[model samples]
Target: MLIVAIILSLIFGSLGFIVTINNAKYLLSGYNTMSEADRAKMDIAGYLRFFKRFHIFLSVTLLAGVLLLYLFNHNWASSYMVLYPLLAYAYLLAKGNTFYRGTSGQKSGTYIGIAILLVVIIAVGSGMFTSLKNSEIVVTESQLEIRGAYGIKIPKADLTNVSVVKQLPAISIKTNGFAAGDYAKGSFRTTEGRKVKLFVNKEAPPFLLLNTREDEIYYSSDEVSSNDLYKKIKKWQKE
Candidate 1:
């Protein structure tokens, strides 16, 4: 049930993004006086373009974020997943439809008012209510094992090792830009030699504390990153 809910939430989020994106374009076209078909295409193409640029990161983060939510609590992920679509919907409304404004030189989408109204209704109807619930995150001193996707752990020993290695990060530095993304850039790999980007570390080794990519990265075609692996570290220090 939980898995199914996660997948469905993803689908809903994707579709919701599409709907709101198109709606925005349509509305903007109305304000800008774009043709019906041109407006429709812009409505979609804009989101598509934006998604393509960030899709690489968004898909990984959202999926991992939701799945990891399962570790904290059963519906924790599901509850947040529900907001994905709502968020996308609200984005278009907020981004506005057109660049042109009224004669007063105040440029705003003519239909934004309507979109905001709908967002308010849909956001509430879609279960936007979440009782502020406080929960503690249990982690180990050496390594905390999260019982979810990769079930990764951050061992105190490894953190110490990384710290120790940090004194001589040159050992972890590679010659080329293979580690280009820096701390900000995280990665996941697949059995088929395919690689995906990620933000969370789910593949750190106990003794490998510094944020160096595993001598050999953790690979899996499925949807998983080592959860605790940090490929992020100082460059020249490693150099």
Candidate 2:
């Protein structure tokens, strides 16, 4: 995740340098699409200068914010990684309107940009809210159910082993799922090359490991004691 943040920061930061006045006609989005008369009405040079400075500042701030959040082990670090860039772009579009002269086309473009930004903000916010919730584990008569994002149900017939371990296997990559701060919920590949479903807090200990015929699941939550949950699952399995 840290690597992903760093790479994104670098990519966005470099964009300002990439779109120069000479290449603005071919590279910049709105500017490239503008009619010659419409382009003439705008202060392209001034906007480019503003653009360069704004993106540089955005990149630096994003990198710094993520680093600080990660160092403190704040769960918000994950949210910051996504939301900061989006909010920055929103600011960019809002402030960018000032550089456009009274061009009707530019006004329409600005409206479209604002509309898209709002939609993206709402979507990302909704997903973050869902992923941040703690996963719930429920035991049924014939199967075990894990509830919340990336949830799944496992039949009792598939259970092969159930135990509690002090530590988790080292995760190599998140194949499909969410990982923020110490909280991780999703599919991950271990350093040993085993794929597992994890709903565990990395900083918390005594994770419940359930080995099934098809997959290994590691689970932990602040809402329940892992040791107690392990015992319950073990007892339930026998019945």
Candidate 3:
């Protein structure tokens, strides 16, 4: 069950991020409304619709994948994590003032898109909370360690280690694949005790994937000096 959960989480998370990047690229490549084309010549709706299509479809697929992930694991609650991805995607599509009041098209596409994005976000966020409401938690002391691409190249010794409650606030799913969340480039101790989480925030979208990078990271769930561990990763990256 644990392995399945991990795999499904990773797969769904990866899919969500992938669709987001592609959508971003496809949307930004062609149009910038600021350029004033002749009013009669311009097809505002048509131009904007191209970008909107990619995001709309991507959001739908991402949400569907998230749902399947939860159903497969019977974790109907963790499903709310889907909102993170949804918000990221929605904001991307709706953030700009794509709608104008003078036009009859004012509330047609853009309004509905924004509305859908918002509604789904609220629905899923509610689910994430209820899912974890009734679960058992175990805590115990452990050790700290760091790892890398090739293998466990670092020991727990170079950096500062802070131990907080094992509870990590649900990170936005859109930021899940990118370094948009708390652990974008850092490490987190996944265990319930003595775990330390590192925060990294230097990633670009469409390329550097957070969850994928996460798999190659190290966790320090126990109390330990991180001197040796940090050095190992530094040296390894250099090599």
Candidate 4:
């Protein structure tokens, strides 16, 4: 997952720089909105230089963060990696309005609003990611416990069926939760018209199906071997 994230960051970051270099006019659409005298006084070249430097800084910081994750897997470093770029980009956006549009700092309320919105978004997004990433399932003799966001604990006595399957049926509806790429960690409805809870990392193979008195749950883990998990659960159920 870290490798995939790093590769995607490198690809997108490089593409942003390429587009900025090749298509400056596309981003400076507001140039025409300026007064004639303001437009004449605009240092178009200087604006482009500022953007180039900003892009480079952003790209390098991301790459560095990726490398740090690859090497150490530090949580603080990971958070810093995400936080710093957003803060830097926010600063750039505020500064750009003044530099490119001749807007005074006091008049850049839109920029300030956007920066605040971005900060809120980053905080919420980071919190969600952390919650999902920390999700885990624990099977005990009396109960199966799911830990993390959208979690629940089911008593073994209430479960009617517990088994492992090679694949899951199609999902009909996501009653709640988030699904991105290969990660599906939340509540969903199966194609068979059953409500299911999912805490899965990869959707493809090796899943556990739990049928309780009221609901069916589907889950898998990236950190543990599926066969080992199945054996553990079966043993716990017998106890």
The best candidate in terms of lDDT: 2
lDDT of 1 by residue, 159-181 (tens): 32223121112223222211210
Q: Against the hidden reference, what TM-scores do the models get?
A: 0.32, 0.90, 0.27, 0.57
lDDT scores in order = 0.39, 0.87, 0.38, 0.68
TM-score order of candidates, top first? 2, 4, 1, 3
List of clashing residue pairs for candidate 4: none
Higher-lDDT candidate among 1 and 4? 4
lDDT by residue (1-239, candidate 3, tens digit) is: 23433464556445534433325334442233323332234344553554455445554555555556655643342343445556766665554434332343543555687788798788656644433222111112222232321112223232222222223433333222222112232333344432222332112111111122224332332223234334543444344
For candidate 1, the per-residue lDDT at 78 reads: 50
Candidate 2 per-residue lDDT over residues 58-150, each given as its tens digit: 888888899888888557888898888898888888887888896576687787898899899889888887877678998989999999989
Give the winner by TM-score: 1 or 3.
1
State residue 158's C-alpha deviation in candidate 3, in Å. Answer: 57
What TM value does model 3 have?
0.27
Identify the runs in model 3 with alpha carbons over 4 angstroms from their true place. Answer: 1-81, 96-107, 135-239
Cα lDDT over the full model 1: 0.39
Ranking by lDDT: 2, 4, 1, 3
Per-model C-alpha RMSD? 17.5, 2.0, 17.0, 6.3
- How many steric clashes between backbone atoms does each model show? 25, 0, 18, 0
